[model samples]
Target: MPTEPYRIAYYTDEQGNKPFREWLQGLRDQIAAVRIRARLTRVKAGNFGPVRNVGEGVVELKIDHGPGYRVYYAIDAGTIILLLCGGHKRTQQRDVEIAQRFWKNHQEQRK
Candidate 1:
């Protein structure tokens, strides 16, 4: 059977503001290399929604040199969709609420 497609996404915070774009680019490159090795294609899914849980395949990975910034991602089928990336870990509740609002607004705009 054919495999499903997987994608990637990224988010950044104030601490990562200056290098967030570059960091994201590097991430894309790394993932691209992995895809090539595994013989798969991955797409980028920028800021889809709030990152609620973090586990084995659904956890936030810290970006080197990026204090307070966590990169949340998920792997599904053959794709890795980056869900959220930002700081403000101290305000988890507020951050989630704000992210939800942003997601809602974005969805509405897509209609």
Candidate 2:
């Protein structure tokens, strides 16, 4: 257990749409949704179950449900986990690209 709780934030694009929340809303599998939320909660508490660094400050939360799902994020400001995007193996590259794009744009905006 972590002494300090991490804050989770969804990445918003120029139009102010939260892609992560949209992805969650689009999930059709109720069980998967429950499990995914549970995992995200654990992450916020610093559990970080099955996470791996993919590159470019992007880390992936690996979920084994179905054909394997992934949630890409970045740890910004030391304690904020910015949820970038979500997808499966087939869309891994595209998802990473989107995440990196959002991360880059965010960094630029901060400066």
Candidate 3:
């Protein structure tokens, strides 16, 4: 179990939009959705999968999907697991950008 048993949360942009949650809802693959939910559940239970440091305090929770799916996140103050973005391997850069944007907004909100 994670030392902090984090609570999962969707990243909201400055405009108060939850793009990540929208993306999840748009997923048409039922099987993939179930698998994704399982993976995210593990994350909430503190079982973050093969974590890869993506820099700037962000990390990727590698979920083994089609060509590999990823959940970009950062543990805020060690208690909240901010779900930054989700995408497949091909959208790695774009997903990173999304995470960065949300992270920047999150920091601003904290101030």
- The candidate maximizing TM-score is 2
Candidate with better TM-score, 1 vs 3: 3
Best by lDDT: 2
Better of 1 and 2 by lDDT: 2
Looking at model 3, the pairs that clash are none
Best-to-worst order by lDDT is 2, 3, 1
Lowest lDDT 10-mer window, candidate 1? Answer: 36-45
**Candidate 2 versus the native: TM-score?**
0.93
Reference-based TM-score of each model: 0.35, 0.93, 0.89
User: lDDT by residue for model 1 over 1-111, one digit each (tens)?
Assistant: 755444544333435442223434455346443432232122242333333464334444333332344544444344555354333346545445544443443345446
Local distance difference test values of all predictions, in order: 0.41, 0.88, 0.82
- Lowest lDDT block of 10, candidate 3: 1-10
Candidate order (TM-score)? 2, 3, 1
